[model samples]
Target: MSTETDVDGGDTGDSLTLALAQLHVDAGEVEANVERALAAVSRAADRGADLVALPELFNVGYFAFDLYARNAEPFGGETFTRLREAAADHGIAVLAGSIVEDLAATESVETPAADGFSNTAALFDADGERRLVYRKHHLFGYESAESELLVPGETLETATIGGMTVGVTTCYDLRFPELYRRLVDAGAELILVPSAWPYPRIEHWQTLSRARAIENQAYVATINGSGEFEEATLLGRSSVYDPWGVPLASSGDEATLITTEIDPRTVVDVRDEFPALRDRRR
Candidate 1:
């Protein structure tokens, strides 16, 4: 797409309207899940959203560990192709959340199998061009063995969309503040978090998301799934927070699309007014 820089060394009035697709995805149903995400995108576009963000592992439910090998697709495979088409069709940037990616194990001699998987997030610009791919760097290990099944990401990535510099992270990455700091260092004005966060930790999800926005002084939009799996139930509380840690729009335990208007200027205004980031010691 266009290589013009919008957020950096540009007018602060630039803003973006975002839609968080809190979809209810069924485990192992790729087609149905893709259709659901497409419907959400259409709705978001109709509402004048500049970009849409889907939940982590949206095509296949999070707890479906056994299905990772069976449902995995390569980086430029069908899942990403469909997302690119949808982004072009809707004329909006699409953050097609995390997917189980089958990376040729030969690429990494440490894990030689010819078939390994990674939890990767794919971003497609409005022109249907693949922009960035961010694999989940920090895999959760509380009760799940995601680290064992998925390869950790190597680099952080950011992109320009709707006149805003945006950074992306998958489910468990929200807990790490350093990652967010790195994104901000890369001139990110907005952060998109795609998660399949489970229940009994709703408070943590909300608290951490708000904390990230407050600390980074950037707009944070988190999209989570809503459904029950054989092993866990997803806590669907997708939300968007402003730079000042204000909840612009949020969702409850249901399959719904949460939309919010984010002004990139607000990040500048909040940081200028509060100057929190400037006073950081580390």
Candidate 2:
């Protein structure tokens, strides 16, 4: 459990109570999985979470490669509208895990492809305003059809919310440190990774997440999915890390919520004290 209090004179927005929804995403079951995610939002809000995040491709499970096209929704379509409504309803921000977005039908933002699909995530504020959108940049090619089936995104967006500069990334983006460096350079204080990592890569998950936080001196929260698929089982290890690379809260291979308080001041203090960021040979 996490408690929330003002870090600064009762009016400081520096503190944020965050929750990670490690959900059991059923393959091709968009309705069921989204309901679960929405329920998790309500649960997190009830427990006093300022923001709650879901895993990558949460509505349509990650390993269900064949179902991406069938379930692909346009940006700001039904799935995201519900999440936006949920955010306003609960008065909490939402990091809607990556969704299969139909680029051709989406008229809101610029698309990477004329009529292809992309893996995208959206952040909605407490007032139900769409804050930021991040499309998965580094698509996984190793033993995965993600690279073949979806068009890669080029947008790197961040939003100012919860007293922090929040940035979003997807699962395979974890392997690319340059992306994180770009985020840090863009004034990101907290990076949320909505991942759908599968089995036999526990060490890779933890290490990559922790390393991103450690190197950037920023908060890193990896929101992973749960449940088994036909060919792979999602390794549910949703976690939150501090600026010092400390695990603030985490969950195992189960459908659970990990809630805890995070502060922007902590990131500021750590960077000011250690100043490892200055050591870079840039």
Which has the greatest TM-score?
2
Candidate 1 weakest lDDT stretch, 10 residues: 1-10
Weakest lDDT window of 10 consecutive positions for candidate 2: 1-10
Off by over 4 Å in 1: 1-14, 105-115
Per residue, candidate 2 scores C-alpha lDDT tens digits across 1-282 of 212111111223448888888888889999988999899899888988889999999999999999999999999789999999999999999999989999988985445556799999999999999999888999998989999999888879889988889999999999999999999999999999999999999999999999999999999999998889898998888888888888887877878888888889988899999999988998
- The residue pairs that clash in candidate 1, if any, are none
TM-score of 1: 0.91
- Return the number of clashes found in candidate 2: 0
Q: Which model scores highest in lDDT?
A: 2
Cα TM-score per model: 0.91, 0.94
lDDT of candidate 1 over 52-121, digit per residue (tens): 9999999987899989888888777788788889899989889998888888822332222335688888
